[model samples]
Target: MTRETLDRQLHHIQDEILLLGSLVEQAMLNAVQSLKNRDRAAAHKIYQADQDINEKRFAIENAILILMATQQPMARDLRMLAAMLEVNTELERMGDYAKGIAKVTQRLGDVEIKIPIQEIEQMASIATSMLHRALGCFISENAMVASQIPAEDDQVDRLYEEIYRQIVHTMIENPDLIDHTNLLLWVAHNLERMADRVTNICERTVFINTGELLEMDTTDDEEELDSE
Candidate 1:
């Protein structure tokens, strides 16, 4: 294939990546909304939608592999394609986190317990926003913007911690609520993992740009410590 054709294929793959990102973002938000409303029907819909996300991820991976095998992308182009593979996997796993949240909602059926809905919603919002920006950095090949995105993960982490503490305190006040609170904790944990995966995507963005595979989460953690 000509270089022009190769470039066109790569752009098409990038657009697919963006589409997958949007789907995962919506899944995360919908999962949390279902939890807040105790909407089992909506949660089931999110769970079923994850199959589509998984299929889309594989489709993107297959396209990248075909390009790599047939076109033989070189240097930066090869790196970009490889990075796309990694980001695609990360996005799919984020979808699983959403599905997990949906499962948690289903499991909590008929169990009335106080949920830290506001804190959980904040976690989802921050995580999905980080994911959105990380994908933008990927498409633009902006290592600088990519590096800045992971730092926002600290916000998600803080919210997760608050949610955990609140849930534990409530459980202590009413031991009978232990089972229900544990399910809520799982939701927070899923959202936290989603944010962590966004950092992985940002790392891929940096790798695509500089050919340097840096552990962005560790760097962000060290920066946080230094600030303290």
Candidate 2:
């Protein structure tokens, strides 16, 4: 295949990845909002939208195979194609996390929130914005902007920490709020994990674009439990 044709295909693949990012962002936002509004229908809608995310993921995988098989790109081009595959995997996981949040929302339908929704909402906001900015970084091949996303991820972690501390304090002091508060904690944990996955995608983009392997804090990394 001609280099021009291969490049065009890469661009198209990148666009599909960005489109998947948009879907994940929308799903996260809608899930959180549905929970806040106690609208199970809206929550289920977010779950239904995940079908599109899955379809787009299949399309991306096909693009990856075609690019790898036909183009036979070397070095940088190959890293980019591989990175796209990795990032899309993370995006699909984010989509699943969104659906998980939506399922929780659906279960809690019409149930008044016992714990505050502000932190998780904030976490979702930061995560969705990071997902968008990370996609922009991918399009522009801007490792700098991609590096900045880890800071936004810090916001998600801080919100998670704050939520955890608050819930612990409330549980110890109030006792009665346990069942309801535990569910909210789980929701916040999922949002926090999703945000961490966004950072992982950003790190992969930085590596793909710049060939620099930079380490960032990952709250979702389960090795910490073993270490502790």
Task: List residue ranges in candidate 2 displaced over 4 A.
Answer: 169-177, 218-228
* TM-score of model number 1: 0.94
Would you list the clashing residue pairs of candidate 2? none
User: Candidate 1: global Cα-lDDT?
Assistant: 0.92
Q: Count the backbone clashes (under 3 Å) in each candidate.
A: 0, 0
Clash-forming residue pairs, model 1: none
- lDDT tens readout by residue for model 1, 14-51: 99999999999999999999999999999999977899
Cα error, candidate 1, residue 113 (Å)? 0.4
Q: What is each predicted model's overall lDDT from 0 to 1? A: 0.92, 0.83
Off by over 4 Å in 1: 219-228
